[model samples]
Target: MNAHHDHTGPHGASPSGDALPTGTTGFTDEPQITLRGPAELADALPYTLGFHPTDSVVLLALHGERGRFGGRLRLGIPRSPREWAPVAEQLAECLVEGCERRGSRPDGIVVFLCQDPGEGESGRRVMERLRPFAQKLRTACGALDVPVYEALCLSGGRFWSYCCPDSDCCPPDGTALAPPGTSVMAAAAAYAGIHVRGSLRDMEARLRPRTARATVIGQERALDAASAALVHRILDTRARKDVRDDTIRLARMLVDRLAEHPPLADQDTSDTRDDALITHEEAAELIVGLQDRRTRDRAAEWMEGPEADHALRLWRALARRCVGAYGEHAAAPLTLAGWVAWSTADEPSARVALGLALEADPEYVFARLLHQACNEQLDPETLRECLRGEREARAQAGTRHAPGTRATARAAGARGVRRRLRARVGRSRGTAQGAPSTGPGSARPAEASGPGVGAHTGRRTGRQEPCGTRDGGPGGDPSGAGGADGSEEGSAR
Candidate 1:
């Protein structure tokens, strides 16, 4: 969580009592795949789970051949759910694909580097995104027949970067370099500096093909516990001279030990909410139970099979695990299982999952990363320029148009149009004309005017005109020739 460390997690912690986890795996980012070829896939028992042994310990293998083999570390960056939201989505997609190709889900995935170096807060936002990602892989992989049987969160961040990389044993590009998710994916692949001595069984064929396998160290007790829960009591009495019946019978039986049976919580049936369908406990429980390759594969199938509709729900449920410190993000486990689905199978559901994550927590960087990464992929330079232009335009517009100015603009435009119309009408109606006539029944201005009449200067009354009459109005003079022989209105016209 500190964003700079090589070892500091319950996961992948050293067997020794050292406060900081230290192992030969070394604090370094390794290329996910340095080996990819027909031979690699062909020799790999093609979908077989791999285990690697070192110093009387074990690590998971990404790919395999007939017996077992190992592959490079598939690493990625942990971005703020807000800062890297859309990009995070894209990153998830890439990781999912990469995992599938690995022929196994990630033996473990580090979703985010603990921001709190002392305490990683794999918070709700983080796990919310992760849970569905895992469930989706399981569901889609089932259809492909490419199975990822075992998966779990492997080792978490180590405060490796804080140390001087110049130190002979210091990790390369791990704690010292940029976070693995973004930079490593963007760059070419590189192997971890810590060399590995692979376990080779001397089973010789003319073509001694090889692949990678991993066995988790220190997690055996937990894994074995899960294994017992998963392994059902199946009786195959018909076969087996070499395989003894009830090997359990040979061992001493403890009368007091009772089988633990956690009740299966019924899934929600209504399905009305916009949130993910699965409960947090459900996703965690499913992930916890998936301790081995076979179980892992089964979980994946459960996701895609008849339970496909619940895939989103399951993801949502699992993501809730991130609320506490131990799960800040559910990346460790989901990443481990998703590798095989990523590389070998196509996962549309998983790819679309970023949107769901953002919906759950828009401010989360993991969600934002989806859109950003996607748009950048479309055209990075163009999008940047466009974004800048849009920002500037918005800034300028803010000054020119105050809030509520929309109504003002409309009013002003309307008023101006009305004024122009009024002026045009006034001009057509003749405003510059002099006061003209008084007729038989109307008051008139003093004027002497006829059909081809005179000017309106100093005219006192219509009676001044030739045809003006007293009956016209008081303003008219009785004997005035204002309209002497013509109708007053005609004269004015």
Candidate 2:
């Protein structure tokens, strides 16, 4: 999620994060906030401290010549990574000072940490800062025999616990939604009730004029590359089934007449793959860029590893997308089974390859799209019903799926909901000779309505049982007798 590091600056929010670009800064006279040396601790802090999940860490640099609680300050932000060395160093110094002032040395310091509006879109500087901090947290805790564990592991159940006990998290709306565990970052943020704040593009407005001045700070090229890559990847997935994806064609049309060549073509095709819509290299690359190095490496290896289940999932996703894109144009021989086999067409085959890629790496979103296709096919009522069970479904997907954590918690909270429904089914069943069940995964217990043993005593004829027990169960009168003519099932029908 993307949210600027806010602070006690605007709207009672804490203004944290790198300054926004000073669009059209006239008379550029301020010594262009350059690093003073090859690279020192102060220089690297801004960039390095950006690594934690957003809101987990905050980076602030206290600067000034006379210690007047001020200086030409530049808060580290997602955009700070371009000139990461200098910003990272400054941020580290700040964190170090914070800890040292309290008679302690920081294991690591992050420049800034903030939400980036959507999943994994935390500020670049936040992630950069966190990269070193996580390592430091791990190293320091492990070395000191401090019973090291992720903040999530400890903070859970005790939602109010926090490293910055003195500082306020987002304005508390309610109690913590998540307990601490492996996902300490998310747990902490959730505890803060901090939803993704501000739009990614709008994040600039959140910064102070002083900090906003850094928006145009030498990151044009990197941002261009990042933006292009991100936008293209997103549009490319429009080919998935049922999607009216005009992104690819529209994108091609937009740039076809441009003087510029496709930079991606020249940059590095080694990581990009053709034929298949997705690739192991691409999967790993996304992981590296979006997640951590260890996670990236692990994902890369899994993309090529053996796992039939993973392969099947990928295949399903790709097939759905290919069919969606091909629409009425899909022409291919079916398998002997006469069912559509995925590995037949360019798009579908790509799905097949994607599935293979997933055998090694299962978290590929495009692959995940296949399942989305299935989800889309559901009716609104059925879909809502499925979402009612989203937690259980996600949990069944297992620990490999981090997104499932919340979903699972939600499901666990609703434990035994089906039992209540089963009780209703049993009640209704007692009223009919045998009645349809409403319980999950349980078939209706109704017997086939045979014409021989009983006549149709439905309200159609207003001739249900006239007497005996209630409905047409064993103790009840036979159909066409007593209350049987006016039985609940008959009335319902």
Candidate 3:
């Protein structure tokens, strides 16, 4: 979710017009070269989205004079043709309104339908099949008062233009795409240090769960046992606070453990080796323990420097181990993974992990906030600064607790009292709150007295409640994301 709007001047032309490829000046005071044809536009797609899209509908907004490139949006193409109309409408309104909210009504839009042909399907058929969908898109945008100027169907190795009518230039059968890194845009991007990441699907594959039956079963069994053991440890009135401490400590230890092992040369082998290094028991414990939002937040402090990379690797491993009934449990680790990735400038992985996190639980506020901020391309430095500030505060607090300090003693005594008070209050609530008690021989308590209730206590009769929500907004992007608001969630303490 690179939602941060970036300002750059690039070449542009009207849908039916020839290239304005002369000396055009951009907002950056750089001479922006004009895009000549569909091939150049196709080449620009990856740079715009930061990755090549597959099975996607992408809209590029042309704004100000010279139709300079502005905001762009991409969404997966709806598989069902019947769904195309509404998808088109939604995409149109989202892009149009989003642009307006950002203070620019786009002059025109560049529509691209990117889908690879299925088995026995030709690129020509893909173009033909999606032609109506493209029209629907054009009509939707037009209705919103922003006409789509160049509607192109990109499939196979070529592109078909719906706006260009000349067979000599536009071609009915479509024109072949330029070889990779050979186009003029490629030269510009290279000179400018712009990187076109590989397809979004490839980035996401690293985070996807393993589907092998043996592996899934082993992980699920480990999860069940770990859940039984750790749930009790976490829920016990006497050891509740200890559990939170232990979870944080274990997460830090694992982060260190992951750091000791460098990544392998090959991605697959690296992933497999990393997965092997983490025992199912360890993975299950971390995955289940991290359900505690405070524990997860504590782990999030590891989101910079060498620690961040290891934390990311550990998170990816944990996510992989989220098999069977524990699938929903992946939200926490996956969100952490995304956050770390984004902080480290790995936008592709960040977006993929966050997307998976949301898919696991759409209501996960942290994921939603991170996803939106990422989509907007908000710089991560703002959040990093906040994290650093907190880290320094913690370090100062730690210094204050040196062994010979009387203040440390007093602070410890105060903390002990607070812990006891909280434990007592928690016990009282557990026994007398609205939650029902099964009374006799029930293995678990009826409902979570409040937050931090473990499912192992008893068979739950109601919908599972969110553990807690994240509080505080994502810090503003220094790159001018003043309008971007991070959605709030209750502090998952």
Per-candidate Cα RMSD to the true structure, in Å, reads 39.9, 27.7, 14.2
> lDDT per model, in order?
0.25, 0.24, 0.62
lDDT (10s digit) by residue, model 2, range 1-493: 1121232111111133233211011112211222211111122221221112222223322221111011011221323234334333333443333333323332321122333333543233333344544344334333532211111111111122112222244222212333222232233334544233222222211110111223223222333443344434433323221111232232223223221322233212311221133332332222112211111111111122133123323223222222211211111101100011221112222222322222222333222222121111111122123223533443565655566565455444332332332232233211111112223212111111111000111111221111112221111222232332211111100
Q: Arrange candidates by lDDT, highest first: which order?
A: 3, 1, 2
lDDT of 3 at 96: 66
Q: Mind giving the per-residue lDDT tens digits that candidate 3 earns over 1-493?
A: 0100111222224433334332211112244566655667776677655677777777777764555665566666666677678767767776666566445667777898888898999888999998998999999999988877678888898888887666776667778888889977677667766666677667666776778899999999998997887776654545655666787878888878778899997877899989988887788878888865545656777888888888899998898888888888888889999889877867656766876776676556667566655544445654555445444544655677665454344334232332332232222211111112122111111101110000011112222211112331222111211222211111221
On TM-score, the stronger of 2 and 3 is 3
Candidate 1 global lDDT: 0.25
lDDT of 1 by residue, 31-51 (tens): 232212111221121111121
Steric clash count of candidate 1: 115
